[model samples]
Target: MQNNLPTRKIIHVDMDAFYASVAQMDNPELKGKAIAVGGAGARGVISAASYEARMFGVRSAMSGRLAIKLCPELIFVKTNFERYKEISKQIRNIFLDYTDLVEPLSLDEAYLDVTVNKIGMPSATLLAQTIRTRIYNEVGLTASAGISINKFIAKIASDYNKPNGQKTVNPEDVLQFLEELDIKKFYGVGKVTAEKMYQRGIFTGKDLKLKSLDYLNEHFGKSGYFYYQVVRGIHNSEVKPNRIRKSLAAERTFSENLSSEIFMLEKLEQIAEEVSKRLNKNKVAGKTITLKIKYSDFTLQTRSKTIPYFVSEKAIILETAKDLLYQDTLSNSVRLLGISLSNLNTDSKNTKTEEKKVINVQLKFEF
Candidate 1:
């Protein structure tokens, strides 16, 4: 089956400790120290931690208070998104010099399809090496690269070597490499899913390969078929460059849950303002407005409404969100509030003159 498919060279490049590394590079004093980028307040979350901090068990998304507890000498630095964006652009330009097929996952990581590169490089391994070396010399930062025939294998191989290194997975070794991998290490397999798979005696890729497609579908729904193919090293998802924005959203988790409708309204207004700003900045507007609510018990609910025309104004977003909120009775005190705009008008011209196409948009929230 693998021999029948078209072979393509894919490379995944990920920056090492992106935010923390930038801080260390800018300030010579912080070069060898344990540093973190995020808020230091009681309710703050760590965005990124340096390798030194990681040694002490500090991690991103962990509470600032908990991070401090883990590493008493942890230095908290405020996030500098502007500087990160500037550095990210420099790295992206380097990728563009090789291939136009560059898909940025975030400011610090990207997947490049170098099967037909501008540099006329035949070997993906050497291309990756050149890219990494150029980035280190020009950007003063280290990046890890993974070279493989597909995105799935490439992304996984990139992490095999951390900090400043690169790894290549030849097409011939794809099957054996996957079979020896732990099921939990597969991308998109969360802790809960891993636990479920373990209970079903599926601990490794080899164990997963033994299950029939029908049996997996019966137990895991649509994702079952996805697992079936990925376990055999079959991931056809392409590295899509210039992907359009599907939605714009903003969310905030409160320090305390609120039961009062008035307080909820205030929070929703603030979130709506953020969504409106992002929509305007992107020069896009959506007809759909979604309101997401999370209760103290972790129960989540979303209410959405699609209007006749695209709207990006904060007043309209807040009004629509408030209407959705009032339609459903309060389930429980809200711990988080979010507002999102979807069904966006991607056309740059005046949308009022264009024929409106109805799109089925669904709201999905992650806690």
Candidate 2:
């Protein structure tokens, strides 16, 4: 059955320590130093950390205080999104020169379908190398590239060699590559999921491949089928250029946990305002408002409500968020609060043909 799948030439490009690297690139004195990009205040969060800082266990999203504790000499730089956005555009243009199908995951990473490119190049490996070199020469930053037959493998391959490196998985090597890979590295498999898999004696792709589709579905819900096919190198998802923004969100972690519901409400108001502002800036409205709460114990939960009409106003967003927040009793003192607007009214076209396709699953963990 796997042999019947259509092959694609996919490349995943990721900028190494993007924000922090960009800072170091701009300032010669900062090169080779342990630096981070984010707020430097006591309550601030680290957005990105240079490789040198990462060596000391400092990481993005860690509190500024904790980051400093990890690397005493770490220099913190405020984020300049404007500059990052401009550089992102420059790198994207380099992609466009090769192929029209470029899907940006963020300012630092993107997926490119080079199965049919403008340069009439046949070797995706060389094309990836050319793209990475172009970015370094033209944009003054290094990028890692991964070439494979699908987005899933390409994404994982890109991470295999960090900083300035590239990896390619030939069509015949996909199955062997995946079978030997750790289940925890399979994109969407989070720590909780990985633990569950371990307890079930499913610790690697080979272990996962042993389960029947029914068994997987019973255990992992809708995502079960995704794991079933991806482990066998059967992904066919296309790189969608100009993808619509599906949701807008804003969240903040407090320096101190808030046990009072009143304090939680106040924080929710600020988050809701930020969400509303982002929705308006994007010129989009949504019917669904979701509230995410992270307890002090690190447990997380979300509550969502769908209204009849689209809304992007702060008043409506705040009202809806407040209602959802009160729908359930507080489980514990919360350390973080977030608001998100989804079910957006953005026009998007289905560009893929009728074929078995797999969506690239990137799991995000928050602390």
RMSD of each: 6.9, 5.6
lDDT of 1 at 261: 94
Worst 10 residues of 1 by lDDT: 358-367
Please, what are the lDDT tens digits per residue for candidate 2 over residues 1-367?
2556767888999999999989998998999999999849877888999999999999987888899998999999989999999999999999999999999999999999888789988889999999999999999999998998889999999999998999999887889999999999998899999999999999899999999999999999999999999999988777889778888999988888899989988888898888888888889999888999999888999999989888999999998888988898989999899999888887343233455555443322110
How does each model score on TM-score?
A: 0.89, 0.90
Q: Model 1, 1-367: lDDT tens per residue?
A: 3555556789999999999999999998999999989948886789999999999999998888899999999999999999999999999999999999999999999999888789777789999999999999999999999998789889988998998999998877889888999998898799999999999999999999999999899999999999999998888777879776788899998887899999999898899999989999989999888889989787889999999999999999999999999997988888788998888897444245645442222212110
Question: Please, what is the whole-model Cα lDDT of each candidate in the order they appear?
Answer: 0.89, 0.89
